[model samples]
Target: MSTILIIEQVLNGLQSGVMLFLMAAGLTLIFGVMGLINLAHGSLYMVGAFAAAAVAGVTGSFVLALIAALAAAALAGAVIEVAVIRRLYDSDHLDQVLATFALILIFSEGTRWVFGSFPLFLDIPDALSGPVTLPGGIQYPLYRLALIGVGLLVAFGLWLLIERTRIGIQIRAGENDREMIAALGVDISKLYTLVFALGAALAGLAGALVGAIQSVQVGMGEPVLILAFVVIVIGGIGSIKGAFIGALLVGLTDTLVGIFLPEVLKLFMDAAPATSAGSSIASMSIYILMSLVLIWRPSGLFGARA
Candidate 1:
């Protein structure tokens, strides 16, 4: 199609990738550091979105909603860690998954009970609602462009947080040897809680940001959760750098294929068949990419050797 359209889609992919990074970054940290397979992490995301929606509705302020989202998600995560996840540390992935899956149901129903089955709406700030002219006569949404800037900022911030500070050192050490870190006088339990809460807060921020564009609903996190899982898996389970790169690769691949597959297929096929086939395969593009990555490197592109 048009070059402008391509550029727009690429931007969409970047936005989506940034959101996924927020989700996956927390997940990778939790898994790598705590050794906990938390299925309920997605629930934290929903909690953030719903909290933001409810607060914004009452307060009429997006900034307040955002703060509430972060607080709610972090509180929920810490509580869960104390009540449920702490016990699962020595347990198997199956038990962790089942318990967290149940948490997902609780979160969905709990949210519906409070907000009802109807979806909550979020409005973009007035300043960001207008379109801005880009290079080459392209006009784009200021809000979306803002999202890209926010995403890039978050990416850099996370890198600095994980790689620079003393806590970051502890997190990396915990990821490498949990027992060793524990033996060295580190309060590993507290560290785990902090990590979980941090992860939840990031997920919440993503939900709040995305809520402006999509409806704020109870089950909104599941789709994103799955995508985040795919992202981390492709990037390598415990690697932040890998997750960032993998997210970008996935976002671009998914958006480009979805937009251009039909046109490419129409070269040899009828428009109707091309459109249908292209749409179907486009949906499958990420999975196919995942399979290819796994086939060539099972541990992921940047995973440490087993």
Candidate 2:
């Protein structure tokens, strides 16, 4: 591939990686802090997208759409944590999984009822609608570039929140020993709710940002959710640093492989066959990477030893 094309693909990878990080960061936090295996997290993502779409359609303001997305997802998360997830805290992993799975169904059906089966569209703001030239004379979409910036800013903000703030200390303590923190006067229940809401807000932000590019439709979150799970698995559950690293790795590998695999295969076989085979292999690249990571580090790249 040409240098410009390669640069473009790398940018795409970074954008994809950033979005995945947003998803995985929340997931890892919820899993680590709450010890709850939530299959319904994706449903929250869908909720965000729908909220953003609906608001944007009405107000024609991306900012308002994002605000709506964050509010709706966080509110939904808090409600779920209080009404349903709170009951499953002491239950086994299987119970949590089953409960959350039911929640996914409920969310999906409810959304479809309200929004119908059609997809919603989100428009890119005029300010970010055009292309910009890079230092190397490469032109790139301003919106996507802005997305990368947003992701990086959020990541930094999360780091500060988790590592530098008082609540951050409590969160870390809870991750280490939930009962101990509770005994020490921390309101564990409230902490759990905050973490859940924070996660939901992050998911919502991701959904709103991505909705401008992709169709906002029911079930759109499932695929991204699966990838987010893969990211946390590869990164090490509960490790934000690991999640960020793993997200970038998966994103780059997937993007680069998809672009180059076909060209490489064409060198060895017929064009059509090569294209199909390459595409299939590209699709499997991330999974293959996950398998390898698991083989090398069963607990994940940064997971604590049992």
Candidate 3:
């Protein structure tokens, strides 16, 4: 590929990584603090997209739509936590999984019933609707550039929250010793609700941002949700630092493989076969990388050894 093409792909990869970080960060936080395996997390993502789409359709304001997304997802998360998820904390993983999976069905059906089975659309804000020139004469989408900025800001904000604040201390403490914090009069239940809502808001933000690029439809969160799980696993469960690093690794690997592997293979085979082989191999690259990482460090790069 040409230098410009490579540069563009790199930007795409960064954008993808940032988005995954948003999702994985939340997933890790929720898992780390609550010790709950929530299969319904993806449902929160879908709720965000639908909320943004619906709001944008009526108000014609992207900012309002984003706000709606955050509010709707956070509200949904808190309600679910109080109504169902709170009961699963002391339960086994299988129970958590079954309950959340049932939630997935309820969310999907509820969404379809309210919005109809048709996909919704979100338009990029006019300010970010065009392409901009980057270093080395690379032209990239303005919306995507904005997304990278937003992701970085969120990452920094999360770092500040986790490392520099009182709530952060409570969160860290809870992660380390939930019972101790509860004994210390930390109102553990309220903290759990806050953390769940925060995580849900982050997922919602991701969904709203990505909805402009991809079609907003039912079950859209499943693919990204799976990728987010992989990201956290590779990064070390409950480690935001690891999640960021892992997300970048997976994003670059996926984008580069999908784009350039065929070109690399052309050197050894016919054009058509090279293309087909390249695509096939690229599809497995992330899983292969995960396997290799597990072999090297089963607890993940940053996770404490089990």
Q: For every model shown, what is its TM-score relative to the native structure?
A: 0.98, 0.98, 0.98
Cα lDDT tens digits, model 3, 1-306, are 589998899889999999999888889999989988878888899999999999999999999999999999999999999999999999999999999999999999999999999999899999889998988899899999999999999999999999999999999999999999999999999999999999999999999999988989999888999989889889988888989999998898899998899999999999999999999999998888888998999988777535
Pairs that collide, model 2: none
lDDT per residue (tens digit) for residues 252-295 in model 2: 99899999999999999999999999999999999999999999
- List residue ranges in candidate 1 displaced over 4 A: none
Please list the residue runs of candidate 2 whose C-alpha ends up more than 4 Å from where it truly belongs after superposition.
none
- lDDT tens readout by residue for model 1, 274-301: 9999999999999999989989889887
Q: Indicate the TM-score of model 2.
A: 0.98
Better candidate number, 2 or 3, judged by lDDT? 2
Q: Cα RMSDs of all predictions?
A: 1.0, 0.9, 0.9
- Judged by lDDT relative to the true structure, which candidate is superior, 1 or 2? 2
lDDT of 3 at 97: 95
